[model samples]
Target: MLGMSTTTGHGHGHTHDGINWAERLGHLQAIDALDRDTHADVAQRLAAGLPEGATVVDIGSGAGGMSSAFGRALAAAGGGTVVLVDAVPALLDAATAHVRAEAPAVEVVSVLADAADPALPELVPAGDLVWASGVVHHLPDQQRGVNTLARMVRPGGRLALREGGLATQCLPWDVGIGTPGLQGRLLAARESWFERMRADMPDVVRLPGGWGRALAAAGLGDVTSLGFLVDHPAPASAPARESVVNWLTFMADMAGEWLSEEDRATVARLIDPHDSAFVGNSDDVFVLSASTVHHGTRPVPPA
Candidate 1:
């Protein structure tokens, strides 16, 4: 939920490892430029599964990017609360602003905290649906967070989670910070992060499978996942072309200690081209996601 650079615990101390406001904004802009109605399409489906009014806990809600979308959906469905939590303060700030600007009618509360912290259970009570996106990759401890998240959702509460995952490795064109290579830097920097995740994160099950397993472990039911890969190529003539530099900053950051300055600069060059396609011309890649949408009931009756 913080900026991309904000890792949960595995600190790289790499100069490239920190929040880049500009790049984050550009990412959102790319979302805006979507050929398909990215958020709206996803939201329509996500909201349909929800009750008219319900409280939600959005984990790893970076700058409230997806939180704003969730909030907007709930607002449209007779109103509800979206509690956006991210450890990063600046991301929370931006998410707050985005929610207000985008979904003013929805009740949005931004909390600064970690998903794996025990204190989280108290902050978000059981039965509140938990929504998360783009927060899992940065987490050093996935099982713990997934377990806690499952418990936070109250009886009959639904949990919809999505994270950046690698179903297929990107081709040369798509293999950059904004693509599969982003995970590469994180893996290179936090060797332990990936190792532990691989042993646990659920067979590259992007959304629902691994997440579903965690939910079932926490006593959840009715789980499902969905996935597809789309390349968001920034056109050379886009207004915010400079945004590309900011966009690739974190990818650069993770690789800072590993890649030479020259290769790193090449990364910038590739991303800056603006027209570069992230979905390379090959069958060996897909931005595969196993989006898990599950429901859970409190095992015990209300005390």
Candidate 2:
């Protein structure tokens, strides 16, 4: 969710061409490092109970980070293969390299398919474990997307997703320092865009049980939710600082549409390369956030 502003800026159909996603990806790479241990633990829990040669698929596997986590866990669970699926060709290419580097013993398959497409189930083979993170919100029809993906889960297999609204998946109003409310304004702009997207896609907001309900709607059972917190403290590392700067800069560029005149001025000052309020050189800059994952299993059909 780190580079979300670029794709859904202001949600009013305005695009920020100046946002450098490559740079955002780089920052995300660093931020993800902070959550490595948490992901590994989650992978282990998900890989448990599966036999040797289990098949795992990570839908919308950006940069192959989750793919690498699951690959390593499955490899340790007596070896298995991980298929990394995404709609972007370049992301798949990068994911291939990342998975190969992080999980050399595990086999990797890269597939390009949109998560929202109905044909998504046909393009990929059935698997023992299917995981989708930070992608469901982009789908036009959340229920159809969930059911379509669930169909690819072999009977008795499990389906897991990391899903949440934009407001719950953002940096705090005060990220320890910098312009006191700069991050808040940026998040407001992002939320405005997300609200618009949600309005267009009613299915997203209509999920009564959130991810768990989506799982049940897909005919899955034993659904459960797991929570994880990402807290990056002050005196942030070099990479963290770089990530924070890149994210704020990009958000500031696209905030004009949703942010008020005063808020826009705040964003401009905070993002100005030479200004004292600039986030890049601010000593108090940091990030603290959290997210949740919903896990469910597909019950074996009656004989």
**Top TM-score prediction, candidate number:** 2
**What are the Cα lDDT values of the candidates?**
0.54, 0.70
Compute each candidate's TM-score over C-alphas: 0.65, 0.82
Candidate 2 lDDT tens digits, 1-303: 211111210112111222333445655566557568777887888888986888898987767777888988976776777888776656666777787787777777777767776777777767899999877767766777789889989999999888862332234456443445655566778777766766765444344557788899899999998877665566666655666766666666655678777766765666677977666666665666667888788899899
lDDT of 2 at 153: 93
Steric collisions counted per model: 11, 0
Candidate 2 local Cα displacement, residue 200, angstroms = 4.9
RMSD of each: 8.2, 6.6
What tens digits encode model 1's per-residue C-alpha lDDT throughout 211-240?
Answer: 557656766666666554444333332323
**Which runs of model 2 end up more than 4 angstroms from their true locations?**
1-24, 165-180, 200-209, 253-255
